[model samples]
Target: MDYVIEAPLVCVCDLDGTLLRSDATLSGFARDGLNRLINAGVHVTVASGRSLQAMRALLNGVELGLPVIGLNGALISELDTGRHLLIRALESTPARAAVAILAAHGASPLITSWDGTQDRVHHVKTMNAASDWWVAEKREYGDPRLRLSEDLEGVAGQEDVVLITGFVPDQAAERLLEQLRAELAGAAIIHAGQHIYCTGWTEFQIQHPQADKGHAVPHLLELTGLRGSTVLACGDHLNDLGMFAAADESIAPANAHASVLAAATATAASNDEDGVIHWLLRRARLIGAS
Candidate 1:
């Protein structure tokens, strides 16, 4: 059932650990509720660390009414049309430094970039079990972005460096995070923590300094012509902090990271319980009531 909701509003939701369950699947309840929101004239969109291609795959059946924030804000694109609304990349100098640093640790980091067209992920042969598994999974999806490179460093040093990512052993990931933070201080935005899918491994991602969800949300609002709309942002991770700061209201799932929960304006049920969709429905009800 659809009800009239006359408010000019927009909702920006994070994918992993918020909209999706622990197993990375969107529940039927959540999927239906999302469509209900769209039917009610709510401008709904997503902000995710996933690439545009991956996001499209994950949200295959959903109708996205606005451009999605992808690659942790390095990209904002229309999922249906595959049109880039905004794209940001790291400087070649710092990008090279990052590639060298990760390679020294024997991490064959995958460099993601765009050539004014489709996204490309460049990598050398896997150097470890974790990276090998990651590559295999990408292959399982038949991800078109995978670009095997003879010289990973050379690829990273080129123009349009969107993201540099790799997986390392748990303890080494922590150490490397600290080292990269210190060495590349302010030159890049570095995120390192437990890899969502790969057990016992830490995933690290390096992106341009300005490429973050917080910086991208405002641009999204303006581009969609919803700049004055009441914006509600939701997430369940540290990367969502910038987005939280930029939003009029912030929400988190019950299972969200401690930091994210503390920063949230409100809390909803765990992702497993379809927290995001529940929260959206409840909010719509309240708006309709008023």
Candidate 2:
């Protein structure tokens, strides 16, 4: 079969249900395809709502040389070197106000921060339960940095806070988001995803107005000496929208949310079918190779 080898195509991908199948595992075809892409000098980066620490654990066995866009673009870190490229954090004043609003609505927020080195600090109220991501964090980090807040007012003013997140039921989350948009006019409100639906709220992240994965993609490309037109991005959620819209070519798996699928230039096989590998093979013209 004829082949087309494109060198150094920059591919930014999402986790969860994109690269990793819905079962939270990487299929062999996907694994081999990713390895092939890396061997061909493609720059593959993980861009997701996951924290840097969590992403590191999930990608531990994969050998990809690229930085990660984490926390919906609030944090960026080099995958191989563990170097922090940039971190856009919420300013204390707005962060505190956000927390107060959530608290009043009977929801608890998860506050995230980074120490000077490899540690992450997460503060949550006593009543809050663990999230799948949070559980993964604890298992990997061995006592992932955590603190209890009688009230988040104490840590609200701390410097270097990157994100303030909370689990809300769908309806309440929707209502709180409406209020937040009005009250915290300059802040960015994102619904990362839902673990379960409670009263209509879902998992959400509150970030600095400027912190968004979409905004981070261009910045990361600049750092890597690449251009927007040279990049291809794949994602499955609203948080992925920013980068999705900004990429030269955008792709989504068949199972992607309607909004996400609508933004992509093409749709690939579902993650269960090793969609990433399937798409990459076609893009590189490697399919049907003997």
Clashes of each: 0, 11
Q: What RMSD value applies to candidate 2?
A: 2.9
Task: Tell me the deviation in Å of residue 25 in model 2.
Answer: 2.8
Candidate no. 1 TM-score: 0.95
Report lDDT (Cα) of residue 66, candidate 1. Answer: 92
lDDT tens digits, residue span 1-290, model 2: 34446555888898877888776667766777777777666777888877766677677667777778987888788766657789888777888888888777766766777655654555553544433355444555655556555557567675467777777666566687788788888665555456532333477678887688789998888887777437888887777888888888888999888998999998988877778667876786665522
Candidate 1, residues 30-126, lDDT tens digits: the string is: 8877877887888889999988878888887888889999999999999998788898899888888898888887667888898666789887865
- The Cα error of candidate 2 at residue 225, in Å, is 1.7
**Overall local distance difference test of candidate 2:** 0.73
| Candidate 1 wrongly placed segments (more than 4 Å) | 286-290
Total clashes for model 1: 0
Quote each prediction's TM-score. 0.95, 0.88
Among the numbered candidates, top lDDT falls to 1
